[model samples]
Target: MFIGAVPKEVVGQVLATVPFDAWGNVYVGCSGSFRFDRAVKMRHPECRVYSNDVSLLTCSIGALAMGREFPVKFKGALAFVEPAIDGLDFRGRVAAVMVAAAMGNFTGKNEYAQVHFRHYREHFRTFVDQALPKLDALVAEIKIEEFYAGDFLEQADRAENSGGGMACFAPTYKGGYERIYKLVNENVEWPAPKYGIWNPDSLPALIVSLEERHIPYCVISDQLLADRTPTTEWRGSNKPVYTYSSNQAASLRRRLPNEVPFKYTPVEPAAITAESKVSMCVVDSKRMTYLKNVYLTKGIEHTTGQINCLVLIDGALAGGFIFAQTRFGDKTRELYMLSDFAIARERRLSKLIPMIATCREVIQPINRRLLIKVEYIVTTAFTTKPVSMKYRGIFELDKRTADHLQYQSAVRNQSIQDVFHEWLRKYAGQGGKPDRQGQAARAEAAGEECALHDAAGV
Candidate 1:
């Protein structure tokens, strides 16, 4: 297995989004395992793929993968390497370095075999039986036209000047690659890296430079750079992978066939339309239990011990929302926080359904149940998207923290029954479902059941 490799599903989605088919030349910077290079070559055989990196081990492996010679001289400094590695040929030497590098201890100052004897032994034992075959297969299919050992920016400049080319950069987010390859460097005496680990702080300037130059490019980053929002985000991985593209690339991508290339596929609920009747009813927290740990990447646990409500669209359980006393500001201020919100997988409903329900319908019931007047309501959303489309028009953007977007709005002064009647009048003569509407109004009038709890198909 390759270290720090992008997930295969993410690679597929990136390929699906990027307009690589139209470009003749593609350059991959910081090509640690050459994963992107291999993917681009596999998809478009006509494109010439170039791989560049500062690590000698990476370049050595690339050379061996292409049946070329290993340029570095070991000078017998690698006596710690196992004898089974067969140091006589390019392929065997490649195997030797790959195994040793995997076994080396990068966290510490020294990486001698004695320091990590057990790891070195284990990797040596499994190199031929497990790792070699994978490498052999990779070499057979990979047809990268050239491999360069130099600064990544030099290669990026080449791609930028090529007139019809694209560049992909997957830089090391954290420092210490130099330490990881210290053992190999000590033996081969490769030159010092002209560039160190990529500083995420430098991303904004680099993005601006690439855009000003009109270079077609993509950058893979660990954290969402909120200064300039990414053109698109792929959620195939556990943590969102943010991809920033140049203006030229963004324009070209928009012209491609697939307009929506996100991972979430739409499966619209049956017989639901813009005219469908919508209602917000109080429900047992257990009714919204299924969505408890799924609203965000961290899970739905954040909304636990908070108030819960469900939204019905066209008399069908569309989704649910949760809120509680504001976790940030003073409790005496009478502010509530909309902690979590989600839609059912089967229903491709508008997000406005939940927003409007939370604001207009649930406010009075929640205020009455809690015995307080909620003068202001706040909500937070986490996304790498340029705009949180759900709250763009309805709520005022209060502030943006590092992790999420915060929005607040004043609670409307209307009664629960008044809001319900207003909704019914708004959707009048739209072939709306009036059956559940009357039931919801009756439940609210009784004060015991403020919401329609038809848990039939939730």
Candidate 2:
């Protein structure tokens, strides 16, 4: 589902621009497939190449491929394949097992399933026959100095402090690692990562974080169009790959490619009717990141204990709300804090959708079913003005701070569906539907360039 494997073309592009001769050590953070690590080791044999990833399974495979001694013994299908895979030492044997497990997990069958089902033995035998030889060859070629399993930020900090080291980060894009590596993670008993994954939408923040902390780094992403930053673009296997560097001099040395700026096209707004609806559902990290980048000023925040929800207006993605458990000491009852709220610029949806979304009556029971008892809902809006227009009608301003305005709202008694229907009825009675002829006349008066206004929300 998630492949960190960098193509040879991109690797060549990276090796050409990065000033590896200046640094004694190179750190590869978020080493998903370790393809870049292998390439770096192959090119710079004299340099100490280290690989670090958040997943234990990824580290295990990386360690074995790079010839590091793995301490853990695997018990299951791999153990049963001792007869098939021969002449492999402890590291090779473990590597073979882990690689096989990862492959099986990628396909619907996990280690447990492969171990239990007799039909799955052929898959293991197939890997032993076809894939193990490649792994053995890679082990012979790659010699990674060390492999680390932890947060990439911590690893990057160490690289910066080391004085003569550089970090290359290919942070996971759009889709987060949680769902992509779910099967392999569960099989390895790896705990959920505490760090945030970066996508094109959240990459600018990541670059700023690295720069502000004075960390020397380069990033490889597929969709990032770096703004005013030193970047080199290359044609990837499927999409264009852009490498962003902290070293402006080195980046400027590379020739720039013919590139096009990214644009977002908003979906046409549907007319409000009795059938027009509002709903909320769980939103994935990928979708949430895109929405945040388009609508919210701060983009995505790397906070723990947060649930992302999608706000739908007539089945279209109108907005999003990120709710987190209160970080403060509140032993009284479970409190839900609204971490971030955003709405589409094109769709003029009511703020009531988000209001009901955060209400205790609406979300409380849903969380209660999962064993969380929520009583109060709280939110903060950061703005220089005395009041935030977004929260004026929906949330009651409870307190105002020097930097932000805090708001609290009471839960409504009616269900969200019932309230939505009533609101629609009232809207229809008020002739809320727009006049198409007037809209067309305004568009003609504004001209073709004005039609591009809807392209802001992507």
Candidate 3:
């Protein structure tokens, strides 16, 4: 129920601070509305772009408004679930960091009235839970709070002086409810439409959860507290105070808003499957590395032959993207190499946690075998070696952390040297790669059979 808004001046500052160009694509994340079409005209009015909204009404309005306002074409639609960002290619990639999230309207009758009444202000807190205790037990539960109920909130929702229907948030329902508002606390973690009104905080939740890993963001805030609110509430005049300030009108540099500082890059859990041109040079190099290093000798007949392909998910795309390997079951078992993952350099581990959860979900069904368990092979950073993990696994790289064989710790070998030998010895124990050995042995065998060419006349 946070009712404050960043002023228009502040909004100008925030938008101006955003860095977008023709080179990189920008990603916009919002729950419902946006505030910068006119500003975009005032700012970089030349860029052609696509915009989308989850609310059908807002998307239509924005499309119409953008078409009329900017000579440049603006295209896109809104969606309840964040639309997948891949499948689009353009000259520039950018970040449309939105400030309005968790603001989708609600449906309960009495619940809808809280947006207006003082008694229910606390009820509008962003993160509402079904079982979670409410800050104010007296306020109704979400089922009661979400919709605009007429019975419980008769005082605030009574008919206007005209004696007709009141404005928005005032449900005519005797009990059932419907409408939307900006809320706090709940966000993309629980992305269904019921929590509360859309607000500034929800944007960060979306960025971190979905786009944070791959995209750079510039926030577009919808602040209600600025000097230009409709009047006091939603029913006021639709026009804002600064209809269209002069292009040179001083842009307001904003004070820091309440948002978590992003710090870590996100991880893409699975790989994407799409048709695109891949060069033979790159594909061969990848196959060479995996074949020589991973599947050479040993019991590779087990998995490499068993699971012929590999899939990669670059979570840094828009939230993230999936990359899949294919087309070459031609040889033994075919496999696709990989692409370095993309992620935001400033998000936290908490943001990436979901990626792992999602990756597991994507591969879980296929990764597991029916009779004898097919192990889940995960690629992790070298730093993660210290933590104890319980699962049958193999390291993508050799680090001292993974060890079950005790003989490697024996004397005549210093601890560090012994550990190295332990891993190297076990790894090399399988001998030369099949590809390498096959080439050399075949060469030698050919030479021996052709002694006449090697030595003398005949």
Ranking by TM-score: 1, 2, 3
Would you estimate the TM-scores of all the predictions?
Answer: 0.49, 0.47, 0.25
Cα lDDT computed for each candidate against the true fold: 0.55, 0.54, 0.24
Please write out the lDDT profile of model 1 over residues 392-430, one tens digit for every residue: 655678887432467777765554344434444443223
Worst 10 residues of 3 by lDDT: 449-458
> Candidate 2's residue-wise lDDT over 1-458, tens digit each?
12557667877877777766566678777776677777777787787877788665566666676555544443443355555555666555555555545555435457665454454455555655565566666566656777777656456555655644545555545545556555444444323345445444655555544443334567777655434443567764567777776555433522223211122222234454556555566644544443443343222233323566665556544445666667773523445554544332222343544565655445655565446655557776543246765567667898875435778765555665665665454332433334332243233222112111111121
Off by over 4 Å in 2: 65-89, 96-120, 174-176, 189-200, 250-458
* RMSD, every candidate, angstroms: 16.6, 18.9, 25.0
Model 1 per-residue lDDT at 69: 72
Ranking by lDDT: 1, 2, 3
lDDT of 3 by residue, 1-458 (tens): 21223245644654554443421222222212233323433455443223333332233234333332111111221122122222211100001111122233331356554353322223322222221232122112111101211121121112111111111111112212123322211222211222222333332232222121222233332333222112121212243322111111123312122111221111222221122111101122223222211112111111122222211123121121222223332221212222122221222211222222223232233333322222222222211123212111222232332211111000111222232233333332332222332233233221111111100110
Model 1: lDDT of residue 286 = 40
Candidate 1, which segments miss by more than 4 Å at Cα?
73-78, 82-87, 105-116, 122-130, 190-193, 236-238, 247-458
Error of 1 at 251 (Å): 8.2
Pairs that clash in candidate 1: 292-300, 293-300
- Candidate 1 residue 60 Cα shift, in angstroms, is 1.0
TM-score winner between candidates 2 and 3: 2
